[model samples]
Target: MPGSEHADRTEDGLSIPRHRVLVTGATGLLGRAVYKEFHNNKDWHALGTGHRRARPRFLRCDLLDEDAVKAVIRDFRPDVIVHCAAERRPHVVERNAEAAVDLNVKATATLAKEAAASKPGAFLIYISTDYVFDGRDPPYGEDDTPEPLNLYGKSKLDGEREALRHCPAVAILRVPVLYGEVEHVEESAVTALWDQVQEGAAGSCMLDHCQQRFPTEVRDVAVVCRALAERQRQDPSSVRGIFHYSAKEQMTKYEMAVAIAQAFHLPASHLMPLTEQPAGAGARRPLNAQLACCRLRQLGLDVQPRPFRTAITDCLWPFLPDKRWRQTVFF
Candidate 1:
């Protein structure tokens, strides 16, 4: 069986079988990074699943459909299932709470059940959010009890429980706001600030300065996910239960805007900071939800994330409107 240790043999003296990995939400920002990490690694054969925007290298599957999820799991017979699909937008989740539950909790539950019932029992990793913490405290450890403030956070917490309920050998990774290579500037919340910066350059712009956020890079999170998969292959019992991964830098959205303006060589005099949550928001967010990464650090994985300024500059470079302006600023 492909799931077994002796599935494939190599020419080298120490032969290792290449495991098949199935990634969900391949088209999304973070999902794309995760799929790329595993797809590029020679140790694993990866197949990604997506909906609406599905294309080559990814199999189209609506996770909400139990039958479709079952078919993918049964046919792919993955040794590892990385569940990254979810209604991640807090406002969107608020608009239709039912739909959020369906995708976040119900769909995750279905995937976990199918993975557990597979012939070899695929190890499942459910990507979660740091929003599970209420943000009242700093450096939340793995064992810390979650106290989510909004529907999105609550739903993700519930998804974690459901995934664990159906699959005992599940690993839950809770990450914070992520930014990385984007198809467009608005694809990621961090990169999206570039638009606001540009708008602020035109006139005054108000940004959230009260809530402290640790914006992590999607590529960094992808690396950690790959490391966990590799650890599971080496020792099935080594990677299980709840874990946390995040960047160490701390800054508010207002500060982030300032950084973005500086990075792109734009004016920030028009930018304003709102120390309180914006009025009429769809949902209430935590003031700070810093996740402690003691576990991953102890596991010998890279816990130090790239500097925010360096990463954000690289991430927004591709979307720069004027090629000559980009050359003038960067060069």
Candidate 2:
């Protein structure tokens, strides 16, 4: 009964049984959000692991190191582990295929096996991507067989299988291009484009006009991860297997760039339209990678992903001047 306060429900009926939640890739976008959510929640014994970072309860452990993974498992014994790390950049993965496999595939398998061995029914939520599909299909569902066009997708699909094989019961949440605000300006793919638009001459950004993507909000994603982690603690049987969560809107990179330009009161005349993938892109891009979140909706989960336009405001608010925004009467 020493740490009983950490467990058990409070008088207000807010706190559930406290769970030891370990989030991997705590330094990354979604990982940071997830870790922050866990850290803020009083019901979670949150511990984050990443490389070369120091937060309140964060550990600096590289997932590629097997000894480090084992050491974390031995020391923490987390009841629920949310794995938000992966080799995401398609071109980067193409250049380093072996490293991709090691990070995306081997790291997941290691974590899953460790979780299974450490705690029975330990929930592992693997953050996957829409690249698992060939992009030829539209609105890919959970049942669709993976046909990855690039190394990143293939590595993620392989990682998915490995996690399924090792973890007791896991939620493989596949997301789309995420946009969020971070300590740095160009942290995510969307923000990278935003940063490009923010600082450049006319006609700087030329984005793909035809390729479609669901611009998922990282805050919405963090909310869902919190639900899954808490459900894993309260009712592990509720969520299992592969699921997709993305914005309802299907936007072109061209449209997204235009939106970003408009959101921050920047000129869009310079944003050129791209018909094909740019030269030296390294890997083939997913031209039609749209994801549907019907599963989460069907399950009646709270805090679904918001429209990309609304999420855009959340990302750009920090960059906008209060009086300038007030003068323009921008919502």
**TM-score against native, each model:** 0.94, 0.88
Give each model's whole-structure lDDT: 0.89, 0.79
Give the TM-score comparing model 2 with the true structure, all chains together: 0.88
- Residue pairs with clashing backbones, model 2: none
Task: Report the Cα lDDT for residue 101, model 1.
Answer: 95
lDDT at position 39, candidate 1: 86
**TM-score of predicted structure 1:** 0.94
Clashes of each: 0, 0
What C-alpha lDDT, on a 0 to 100 scale, does residue 324 get in candidate 1? 99
Worst 10 residues of 2 by lDDT: 1-10
Q: How accurate is candidate 2 locally (lDDT)?
A: 0.79
For residue 324, model 1's alpha carbon misses the true position, in angstroms, by 0.7
